[model samples]
Target: MPPSLPSPSSVTRAAITLPILARAASTTSAGTAVTPNKPPPSKDHHVHTYSPEAFPLGYTVSSTHAGIKKKAGALDLGILVSTSDTPCSAAACMTRNVFKAAPVTVTSELLRNSNGRAKGFIINSGCANAVTGKKGLEDAWSMSNTTTSQLPPSGAQSDKEGTLVMSTGVIGQHLPISSILDKIPELIRTLDDSPKSWLDLSKAFMTTDTFPKLRAKTFKIGDRLIRMAGIDKGAGMIAPNMGPPQPPHATLLGVIATDAAIKPEDLQNALNYAVDRSFNNITVDGDMSTNDTILCLANGAAGSAEHGGRETEEKMKELTEKANPEEFGIFKEQLREFAEELAQLVVRDGEGATKFVTIRVKGAPTYEIANAVAKSVANSSLFKTAMYGEDANWGRILCAVGYTPLSPNPISPTSVSVSFLPPAASSNTTPLRLLTNGEPEPNIDEARASEILKEEDLEIEIDLGDGNEEAKVWTCDFSHEYVTINGSAEEEEGWMYD
Candidate 1:
């Protein structure tokens, strides 16, 4: 396991209060649920208002109200620029949906053409340039070109300083290209390396997100301190299929900036490892969007140039091959933790979702089977509804697992078992064992199981007893509000900002 973060007492008081304040401000009217329309508090505690800054050096963020969103003054366009003297090395993972958006196409081309180097990112919310065909492509290209033209001379680096674009909101709509272009100058002028700027950038990219999602951590390689800060916007349509360094997608847009001096290829490898274990392991409504994207930029502002020369490629290759385990492990762990935290936040704030559910499938014949089984359970409407109702309905889970089409390896009913574990705060309570060897436990306490299911976070463990392989997935309970929110998404788009 990665090292545990020090308790807030060991860190700073803000470390404990910031997340609480952010979470509190994001709650629905009932104070327990999350809704897409709730705007973040005006005085966000997540900003560097108290102690300990939230971002790495050499990175600045800015946002502007481009009049794309229905609400006046709601920030709809944003940019994050890496101001390192040298070009920033970038790694990205985009959605695998075949029907990708225009911005996704442009981002893929830029990553390919520029060879994984970028100066900054340009993002817009409230008008997803998806399914708009030729015109959409031109508009996306225009966004990048206009943003690039506004950069200072030092910030521009020929083809090396590629600009990535991300758009999220109403699909099949053309972007307000003129408004976005007009705001470019102001956006660039407001860029600052402050925590408030990062927080604003996070909020600027939200479509239906109830709160700004941001996380930051500081780690050390040798004696030099390196910081990794990330912000993401996603609340629904969030089953991200983001694969290794690729393109872009919709709904989810994450940007992680680090000051660690690492090669682009190595950064890509680290991002892939982290994404597979984090974003790829989560599901919210199980509807993958056309514009899911996660981008990581390393500007090496910390000056740990131990891996900055031509020999760096060979060293990175060795690290990838596990020939140099220590340094590679440190980088991989830090990146994974960063990605995992953001991914979990996405699920925790799943639109109208009341409970966070973790589905763990164990004893499968192979990891692939375990993963499939976990996803089947995680995405099951019956299981999710049961969870939301706090019902100890283990049969729904078994049905989901059994119908997963595992091909030739038929599951043996007699070898199945299931258990429900409550949240960590209730450690004094024992896990409720619902099944044993495919038979309902004779001493099962249905009331206890139902009570445990009422917790905000739940863990359902399934044992196939087929083999030793295991996989885990994160999901959320499906409530009536989930259906209501999605059902009205189109009709209520204009009023969501109210």
Candidate 2:
């Protein structure tokens, strides 16, 4: 079972009292006024910031502080809206964790009720609405209803037209629904489709993250240009297992918006394919969050006939049968590439991470075996620490691969080989072979191997010598600072509630 929330009596009283305290401070007598004690600043905000270069067409983003976070002027609430004339097509990948947050539950129901269509998303930081049970669900519904109420009426409103909600930060706390609802009008009025708005929205979603993650790309499909922009927030508890929207359980929240108008099924297929190679292949702390969500909204505002139009049904059918190399291949590849870039940025900005590492496994009998082997090596603490210390400990790498239990087809240690390469910037460097056929290579240069490990980025390649299938996993070296950041997180937030 998930963690239990605070006792109802104490929680209810605190919740009812906080708003009264804020209001009391403004009350004044004829001659004098009384001042209420102010809460301490939140320790959650860090120095890292970001600036976005471009934003997707037909989308506007904005953020504001709603007192969920104690820090003054910190952006704790945000919303992203699609401004197309018609409803936008949507695709989502959610976490598979059993204990889902309120927002995750609400979003999943909304998507199913609407048949994969939505107009906007509302996100909040500093209070993750998990473990609050029935009341949490009610609060999440209130958030969506308030947002929809504030928007201009377009025809009739249904669950499908409701905005998606996402929350991050401290777990097991009830959201300050009153404060959040009060800010809906201001948040709606400030929405803009400018680059700065996107950047601010990205920053508003951050928690333990040291920096914002944002990426944008434009692809041409026959004379018309379609643009996609994405922003994500994760620095801890960052392993993600996002899949189709049915049983949502991933925590690293990401939002991708595009101007291409594609069928919902086709968009969902593309999102799952991209996630398998990108988000699913990276690990920060090897722990998954209960609120992981990746959503993509395509508004088709680019006026591109080739991408989406009256013939969308036929084009989607053709894509399902077999991608047309000349037509669909370019768009598919661009989407995958953009997702991969964003995934890499997540690792690069990992909390206290100093070295970015890539683990590649080849020659496996199946893609599943290849992925298992790569992740085992990438998530091993001994290997990560060895990299942080600049130690060329190839034995640790080999040990991790040897323990990956491959069912049906057992791996033979005698058929495995390992090699490490220097950073790409070093043109004169050569890859150092550590093992051949499971034995240490003769006359190996330990000095050169150690030199390669000193670079900020490195790659380790492993060959199972079983078949031709391959997989790649991205990770970062573990450092002392990582422990320090996590060790103090709970203490920092604990003071706020007290």
Candidate 3:
């Protein structure tokens, strides 16, 4: 199920209350240092805000010294190192695309080698360590090892902690590790006990992403407040995957940190549950990445919830979900909700997306089937371009289904039925061959169709007419802007390709 929107309380006041909370939280911790040219609250849904008190896991972030994609700059790298060996857990869902990136491959190995034990996180934006083969792997491993070595030795200094690393931006390029190494010292100096630092870290991960993405949660155990913070990077090429096709399952790259006092195993379980409900539930491109990673680290700095403080528990429950009796399920639910919201923001800012569209597929044999059909519609360039042109071309939607993996190979030429809701983008004055079995009349008024296409949100559903599989995928319409964003580097600065 597409997870029903949280109780109206969670989102209803989010717009208004969230801002007050962010302001109050910011002023209390870091004073009133405002950012410039900040857009008014009502203008864009592409960015959201939260309180810092929600993440107290003592974080130290530094940038990548290597600089730009092809040039050297100041502070483009970052690290999220924990001060303690706090127990942590995570769950991720990556791209199904076969050409996985080097960073994704190495990070998967590290996570598997450590068995959920992640110490710190390393990330670079200018280059995506992909398609470089052995040398790329070498670069990824070397970067991981360097990050591992920088941590304050464990033994007596701190308990045991694991590390996760991520890279984003144009694919098929090598990272400038030397520049990153040199800048590490200076980047480290900027780290203070402030939330803005982590926000800066999130911003540094952007490639074509227009804004920093982040989410935080705070829960009170007994007399203490436990906090978790996360950062993600994705503005394009997103999709759903079945994961490894077997075994321990699949994962994604979503970095989350918490300052809760919980056992490592417990944290892992919580993280898994959270990801399943959150990141795993979304799809943007139907084209998975080779470098999708999400790692969570914990440093028991805030201490766990005391078992007896009823007062503290109630107060914490107001903002943070409770974890006892498992009744406090709201914590992970809210996190997933916020994360989905963040992911949508990425799509709204999708390189050239002037409008964000949501494709909902229901009434199928299973969620998987619905998802398959959804992706077919979401990823089809025909469907996308039609969307871009504001043309209600149901034929394109039907064409997408015909090519989808779900389409019966031998081409069942029959046994399938499809339909579109009223105001569909079709110009057939007469009811055409819209229904194969028990489907709607395949005809729509051109005027109504055009009006429907003008709306910002879109919903498309398909009934395989098979059993009852259900799936839903999300994507933006293909526009000339998308083309422009994907063009050569020079075109990115100015000039257009005629």
Among all candidates shown, the one with the greatest lDDT? 1
- Give model 1 RMSD, 1 decimal: 10.9
Residue 311 of model 3, lDDT score: 19
- lDDT string, candidate 1, 28-115, tens digits: 5676644233222232433333123446767888998998987889988999988876568888898888888898899888887887
For residues 434-498, write the lDDT of model 3, one tens digit per residue.
34553335343455455555556555556565565565455676666565656655311322110
Q: What are the Cα lDDT values of the candidates?
A: 0.76, 0.75, 0.55
State TM-scores per candidate.
Answer: 0.84, 0.83, 0.70
Output the TM-score of candidate 1: 0.84
Give residue 291's error in model 3 in angstroms: 1.5
lDDT of 2 by residue, 267-368 (tens): 788888889999999998798888888888877766444543222322222233154445455666777888888788777767677778999999999999
User: How far in Å is the alpha carbon of 168 misplaced in model 2?
Assistant: 0.9
Model 3 residue 267 CA deviation in Å? 5.3
Which run of 10 residues does model 1 get worst, by summed lDDT? 16-25
Superposed model 1: Cα runs more than 4 Å off: 1-52, 155-158, 245-250, 303-324, 489-498
Off by over 4 Å in 3: 1-45, 70-75, 90-99, 153-162, 217-226, 240-253, 260-286, 300-332, 407-448, 461-470, 490-498
Stretches off by above 4 angstroms in model 2 are 1-53, 154-159, 247-250, 304-326, 489-498
Question: In model 3, how many backbone clashes occur?
Answer: 45
How many angstroms is residue 385 displaced in model 1 relative to the true structure, after the best TM-score fit? 0.7
